[model samples]
Target: MTIQSLGVGSGLALDDLVTQLLSAEREPKEKRLNDKEERIEAEISALGQIKSKLSDFKETVDEMRRDSDINGREPTITHPSEDKDIFTAEASNSALRGSYEIAVTELASGSRIETADAAYTESTDQVLTDGLGSTTMTFKINNTGDSFTVSVTQNMTLAQLREAINNNENNFGVNANIIDTGTATGGAKLVFTSDVTGAGNDLVIVNDGDRAELDSLTTTDSTETATNLSPVKSATNAKATIDGIPVESETNEFENTIQNVSFEATSVSPLDTDGITRVTSTLEIGYDRDGLDKKIRDFVDNYNKIISDIQSLTRYGESDLEEDGALAGDSMLRGISNGLASIVGSSVDSSSLGGLFALGVELNSDGKLEIPTTDFGLGTGDERLEAALEDNFDEIAKLFTDEDQGIAVRLYEMANEYTSYSGLITLRERAAKDDKDQIADDRERFELRMVSYEQILRDRYLNLDQTVARLNQTGSALLAALG
Candidate 1:
């Protein structure tokens, strides 16, 4: 049988009374937790935003650091194949985590090309079959190497064919255009041109469509490996050495190689012709201190608030409205509340990070993570830390950022390892949230029950009022009759 509450009546059910008391006892606690969660969420979101900004800021600082070092060396970029001032450098490292040191000469020009587009069967130029003006075909472009095919309609208008050719930009290395000859009898003619300038990979028009006695050239699109680069010479031609290993260059400078070698350019290298000295460098890609602090503060405030609610529900003092709280002495709630102690002392190998502990980032007597210093300001210990970093960066990056070993990564993995209901923060947090949600559901049920009780009480009162009025009228009538 379904149970419903009768709020008030001449007679009351024991179950209804208990339920009303329970609602009063649980509502406040759930409300406390919900309010706490909102504040925590705000803090978390604020932290995330700040951290993102900080990461960018850090990248800017790093770039500045790079630029500040020997004035950012200008490097020339080039296409792989081409006969011109071409330079190359290579670096190799036993580990994956260090920056490069190079002396690069700026190239006079950098050559690049767009990948080919798809092919289609709707042609325009004299390149198409006769009487196929209304017909259309299609094809595709390949990046590594390869020419694509296209067919034009017979005697198609130059403008119409040009449109068709341009329409198949995917297959063509170049875009097509129609030129107005300006002659009274002349109309626009289709012209195909390359988007890039260079000897290698220069636009080559292939005979993909039938010439039908126009001289049938049978071949598919072929990969056009580039040749002839721009005037960017290797500075090492004069003299260069990589980590004391003497290296040779034919032109001005070497760049983008895996090796951490520096070239001693004989004179002031005119690498960047743009004369643009300062360019914004690396893009920042990590979190910052303020963001982290905000997260920490949020966790603290939220955790505290949840604690307060739990205390409110499980141990309401005499001063509280309720003498005995609804969840009082619930072992599960108390146990869950205490589970927060785990992360506070969550251990990471202090030595693994190389003097990570000496920076006033310490473990307290009670085994909690402590940063007596205001910031994760390893940057302040710049000179000494940098000196150390020069030698141990790979290890340091590994301990703090590597997916398997970094603190953040470890915490992230742990955060999702939920034994019960899954959540982001801590197990205790998950438990508290789950508890709060559960109680909130109970509160909803209680409110529904209260509505039924209110109706029953109203009806009972009405009946009593009517009965008294009837009795009064009957008594008056009897008295009059007796008189």
Candidate 2:
């Protein structure tokens, strides 16, 4: 007899036995795989966290490694009056530390030209005659040779001409508009303004087509020999005097006039009571002490932040009940922390400022950077930092940016070694993932084996069921014959 289910013939609980056996075989192996996978996942998470922190620290160090950012110039202007500003000035790193007296005489201006009185009877008046076909008006700046053309159709109105000039794609800073003077003498007058500012650089509109009807909008005569439009304002250069020495610029801003300093004239300086001599303002160029100080403080903060993150990621739990850190006992974190500390503590040969110590930056008991309050014969951290900024300001840049042994340079290089595309952290993450994949394979194989083991158990139970069923039938037949 064939048994359809386990224990059907024997009336025994073989199904429960098969279930218990499978459970016993699967529980231990599954628990091991689960524990291993959890550890690898934690490792991956910890690696990502440390890599992110290092990248941030590297970016900050990258900026600090540049000398231009550390060595800066501060320009201060003191006008004659408290309310009015005569000019604004900026200085570069190469600017010398000095004071100058500047007086602004004139501000730079652009040219403004307007059409002759009643140039057009109305805004709708035709600019080109019906048989004139088309006219091309060219706008030119005399000194700069910058020019653009406007195409006027034969039936184009004065308003349409203004739109064409303004809408030209090649227009280099020329603006055209019409103003209604509200009378026949000065009817609708078209105005042309040129942004080209300099003495002798005038806006000269040419009647390229030589059409007399378009002469009202042109600066030149029909024969291109004389002026037709009225000059409202002339283009002029900005003028100022430095220390009684006269200077001029095409625009309001004077660049490199004082070596590496540039200043923009806002308005004419105040005149004396006689209205002849102009009052002067004082401009002083000095080292950007406050800016450098802030950068230094920021560097210290960023360094400390990275250190704190590494510490948190690598620390171990003290008690058995507490869980350990994801990266506990990891050597990579220790190496990174130690490497940064070593660079921060080491001295540089390039800068006269020596090292971070010269800037009053110290490593605290917790192995983090700080500006301490304690004084050690030299001065308190704050006092030393202030003195360094006041005295050896420029040398401070070499301490952190020098190519050979700069703190910032070395720190950046070290961080890159660990966080780069194929760096140590990335390799560690890959290896952890590989282990996880291996565990997954092991789990799949174990499941396949469990399936085969269940089949074997069911086959043995089926035989047991058949044997018991045959014996019961034999015993029942024997008892019935005896009765």
Candidate 3:
């Protein structure tokens, strides 16, 4: 009764016709917008990848700028005798390269004290301080006169006192623990150890109150009335000699005793037992050539990786699919590539080693940097690098670390320009995102217009169908009268 049977009156496929017309108008615009969106997305992805590569390149450059870089002076240590556990040493770049004799006479030790074996029992619920009136226990370290206090309260167990002392905020350089002997005669003993090692740094306990319970916990040396605690070990300073010159330290580890050289006294020299009392160990400090070589090689490898990524992204190909590299024709990529190449190819001023090419790094036919293992008829490549490092070491370091014209410094600065928060890459990405947003807005408006156009087509067709039905009815009535 309604428009369901209207197709017969109109003699035309109205629904299909309207659909075809609307699709024809919408399809092309939608396809164009979708293609633009995809291109912008691809560009954003490409920028992210480029930024990552630049950051990696910057890391290598930063290493080269440091004084501790492998390209700089490297120190190597050699011990003359094997199995000399008496001592071990490390030399820094600041250390003068020389040979020195060392002797370890004694290793430093910490102060240790144990409470009298009868002080505590294995029973957890037994309160040792029940009868002990409130008292103040003071601990001093290093004879510094700086002390920490522990207030012993009534009804406190031996375990509780240990925890209170350990958890005290003011307590420094001391640790307390409860040791259970598990024997009837030796129930439990509280032990205290000085965290610091050295001759003058000793743990001293003093009881301030008249409480006998607190006085019993102090060592005999600190209090005459103290008989419940005994000193098991005395704090002692480490003793050693460099080239027969005596040296003393609070700890076994000796620092700056030999001009930028630090060492730890592990055990007494074996020569002491033989009655020789002479140097037990000899130390040699020198330049590490192999270490520097490995570092330079790693820097070259990281540089090449960055170059390869840039080349891949900017390359052009014949086929459509193969030619779709996101940054193929990007001007920003071109500028970045040119800037890096210029910096690498430039020379540092006031340096005997002019540039990387003179010191083993060379650009190949493929536009990538490579370090050849063997010299290919040119005396200027890998062989030159080794000779320069061995013969003119200072010049090689100056070439890469020169403050004004160093290649590493310039390259690091250049990378920062593109990778920084407000850099070129970030700006380009922002522009691309804006373009995508505009395209999305356009698509939304187009869809809305199509919806309104579709309704117009449906209204016009419905009116046409009704008008054609009325005309058919009139003609049938006329034919009936004529017959």
Candidate 4:
């Protein structure tokens, strides 16, 4: 049987004493390991916050690098005398500033044709050709004479014929449909329309079968046929004039007709007393000032947010009772903050727009940036940035986007150094994780050693208890012998 405890025979608290001795040695060591682990974990979390802030700041800088980025170009249009509903225009980055007189003479039209009424009296499933030979139908567009052919075999229904024409691989610029007139004699009719809109791009359908049989099914003439299959609409080109110069387009929308400007003619111009169209509308393209200002303001707001975050993380408290931030006194944070400030203050040699200061962006006492409403001793007025842009458009553009010297370019390059896969932030996080793992390993080894040490102390105390019991029994035997 196992003994209850080492102190049972000796009548002393040997187990309690051993536990007290071992705890004295283990508590301090365990606390040290725990403290180290806590510090490493805190560092890892702080680095993650830094990485997130840097990423947001980088996005703002990237916007300044490309022409299509935020506030890159703003184009506006003003019409003097015409209704905007009649026509509308849009301008691209390449559009030049100018005013032009535009007169819409005509709008483009597409070709539409419908078959004669009652083209199919039988059910939709009935064979279209009876027992006769196959019938071949040809379709042409734009009078080019290049045709696509559709063949109808015996036992094919009118519905099947519609599907065959649409599924034909050679068919181009034309589509067919079946329309029901809801009458006994005019049961159903087949219609065809040209996808393209132009003067000559008409849908011409001709059948190579018997004239009477083919005429009952489809029509090729411009006028109404006996089968009721006739042209409902004719193809026509769009006509307009730019500055008294006539221009023709296959569609109502015209692109690149006058530099980078594109316009769509939605309605015909009002006519004069002589039955000729004479109305003209003025088209103007210019820079959008409000849009550019909004972009600049957004950049300032984002920069300020980053600055506030860094400052909070690295600030030292004023008193002992005040707690310090997780990353207080961190050298990495200091380096990043200084580097961004330097880039913003440095001037670019490629443009007259020196730096952010010249652009009306100033750092406040709190280390955050702001766009001031009034001039900061700069000769330019309260709206200095806007004035600069209006006067020196090219120089302002170069200041933000120059190849190697631009402020935006330099900031982007610095951000990549901290956020890349092999960046300093990534390496620091990895090192902290390794230190935490080592502390865990040490704690496990210490616990195992404590278990062995406790067992050794119990064995030594058990031997001492046995020796004291024997001595007590010997004393009792001597007292009885003397009595």
Candidate 5:
């Protein structure tokens, strides 16, 4: 650590200067090595952050797998408490010839006439009994009962009036029909019928004339809602069964949750219901199946990234010997790699529909896992995808979460138990904070020690320089004195 001071011309302490300079210069190198280590730790720390998010997202994907309708599609869903099993085909064979008393309520207000012809009308049998003009609408009362007429001003169309008659088949117990043409008599006439002999789904229409009743279009009253009234066609004909659920709808619009698959029928029904008519509807879902897919993709992408990063850590420094370094021998990464390799090729059990596709899954040349299906034209399928999904979803989910089969298991283990859903990111976050803290601390100590070493070296070198310079000066003085 000594420094020759002759180079200072003997005017200063050269040894001290050199020692200080040397110590200072050498110290940063060691300090820099420590800094480099901190940087590597930080890099690892950041990767861990992304890893934690992927684990949470993985659990979400697993849960949705059990609930998805399409293989990898999302849904739009709103759980509103409307009514359940509200369909009351309480309608039967007698539905065509039912009657009951009616009390109409006008939504708007004004001076009104007790429209004999304009009063309560019906569509049932209208087209059948009357000709095309009968299509104007008519209703015959099967049972007048004791029901009185509530006067109103609004004119009821054959369609509107027909709906009014059948609105509460179960509640009011009435069905209405109109004759297609004028009765053998004259004037348009509306008819009301009772599906049940007693009076279920039947009604009497009261106008401003002598009250009349026509159970079988007998034209009991001359002052009915309409006279010579035509008949409107019968009620709507709707019947369908999407998968196995029967539906009765006027149009193609219905929502049902059956067989654990959310159905959004639209203009189409997959199965025929023989006689039961259903509405055609378009099925739609929000943020469910497709959401889960995005979630799964996130998991896979993060997984691959972590694996690649770990790979680099093991064989760093461009040396053959580095190939056997820390990451290269990491058992955790090896386990994860093997786990991924297995899931990519696992097939399904196909015993259900006569082993429709004996081959469970196929890998396309594009590296996509193609699920085998029947029929292939999308009627459920040539082979039913629905059937396969029903039979195999549980097994598919196992590959993502089970200790022996799931990616999460190996991924969590690779994370050194730092990633988990049981406890929300507590361990992981601390690991990150502690890492950054260690880097800062090591950098600080390294900087301080480097400063000290430099000072010591500088002092030694300066002292040597001073000593050498003094000897030269003394030799010069001796020569002068001898002269």
Candidate 6:
């Protein structure tokens, strides 16, 4: 009398009936949850895609809003001859447009000093001849305490002494070498060169120990005066003449000599026909028209890309055969697209040249930016762009970089409103995620309800099953009594 299975005791298809009832109860609610989850997921995905694109657009506009990208200067040099590279020059945005005649007379040189002839008979000769243990010698730059010492042992030869001096860790730019004059009169001479390049900065060696033989290597006395070594070359400054005016620098690079212009003297200019007069090269500073033009074109292209993405995201299907966009009919997306167009088409008051139209950038009928090749009233797009770059180059920077009214500045701020961490798009995405989580909780509750409903249906069928079984037994008993 206990129903082990739904149809076992009743002789009816109760299992199939129970299955149909559960289906009727669960299908509608489950379908609603599934549809909602799919919609929320699509919306979250679309929001993420748009947020990424907007961030990229923001980065591009941020760079365009910088003055360095808009106002740049280009330096052009014309050497006196194609074969000779006399000098190279560079100019900054602050440099004025002008041409100058530059003549490099002399290149800066460091000091060189060599030992006297017959200083040492051979490379194997010991440095400390009079002393037994060792002697230390100090090498210094003239008039400064900057010096390094080399310890010469009794067994240290002229060659080894040169190596020791050259290999010392504290050695400050002094290089040592031996020049064999091939005779005793100019025997193996130890030469020293200093990279210290000013006119008064000279290299000198001093004998720190009381070894008379060490004096052979000393270039200065205890008072740091030049006394022994012969001066091969004196430290000299780089000399140049700009517009027939003289200028000199301790190093080869001359900075700001010509108001915001810096030039490096590579080599002396070629001599003219007279062999005494040095030829001059031309250095010209002008606005970087090409660079500015490219930046303007990039801005137009990038803006158009954003517009295209927005159009795709917010567009509805044209027919029943096509599926609608994920963000179709979204007011927020429409507002973003409209806001972008408004800012781009608006005028900026900070620049005298006005907004993007002055630079030949225009919004087309399709809500995208373009630099048309067609000719209109003032000039063609290329012509207007070229004129702007040539005449109002600095104004172009103001139009895009000014804090109050720059187009790029305003656009960036607008994009930031939607793409920032606590922005509208992020908040919307988080809300969609919350809804999906709620759907999961609903599904769990729905499963629990199905379990309870199944138990109730089984319990109600059990009573009818017992009554039918008892009635069948009584009818059989009455038939037997009549027989």
- The TM-score values for the models, in the order shown, are 0.43, 0.93, 0.85, 0.81, 0.38, 0.81
For every candidate structure, what is the RMSD over all alpha carbons to the true structure, in angstroms?
13.0, 2.3, 4.0, 4.7, 17.1, 4.2
Best by lDDT: 2
lDDT of 6 at 98: 97
lDDT of 4 by residue, 1-483 (tens): 234787776678888888898899789998998888888888888889888988888888888765545324344444434345557887776677788888889999878987666766533844354567687777777466657888878777878888988999988867778878778798777778877688877777776564445665556532333332557898989999988999988899988897787899888777666887667777777765566667677877887777777888888898999867778989998899889888877888988878776667777677677767764467433367777667765566567788788877888889889988999888988888998899889988999999988888777887877777677668889999999
Prediction-by-prediction clash tally: 50, 0, 2, 5, 104, 0
As for TM-score, the candidate ahead, 5 or 6, is: 6
Between prediction 3 and prediction 6, which has the larger TM-score? 3
lDDT of each: 0.39, 0.89, 0.76, 0.76, 0.40, 0.86
Q: Which digits, one per residue and each the tens of the lDDT, describe model 1 over residues 384-473?
A: 334434444334334334444344344333323422144322344445556656756866886677677666655565565455556666
- Of 2 and 3, the candidate ahead on TM-score is 2
Score candidate 4 by lDDT. Answer: 0.76
Writing each residue's lDDT as its tens digit, candidate 6 over 201-314 gives 777788776466766788765665547664689888899999999999888999999988999999999899999998899999999889889988988888888877778878
Sort by TM-score, best first.
2, 3, 4, 6, 1, 5
lDDT of 3 at 240: 83
Candidate 3 stretches greater than 4 Å from native: 1-8, 70-88, 114-132, 142-146, 155-170, 175-191, 210-213, 219-232, 267-269, 272-279, 319-321, 374-380, 479-482
Cα distance off (Å), candidate 5, residue 81: 30
> After superposition, which runs of candidate 2 have C-alpha atoms over 4 Å from their true positions?
1-4, 221-227, 272-274, 476-483
Ordered by lDDT, highest first, the candidates read: 2, 6, 3, 4, 5, 1
Tell me the deviation in Å of residue 75 in model 3.
4.8
Residue 386 accuracy (lDDT) in model 6: 91
Instruction: For candidate 5, give the lDDT of residue 344.
Output: 48
Compared with the true structure, model 4 gives a TM-score of 0.81
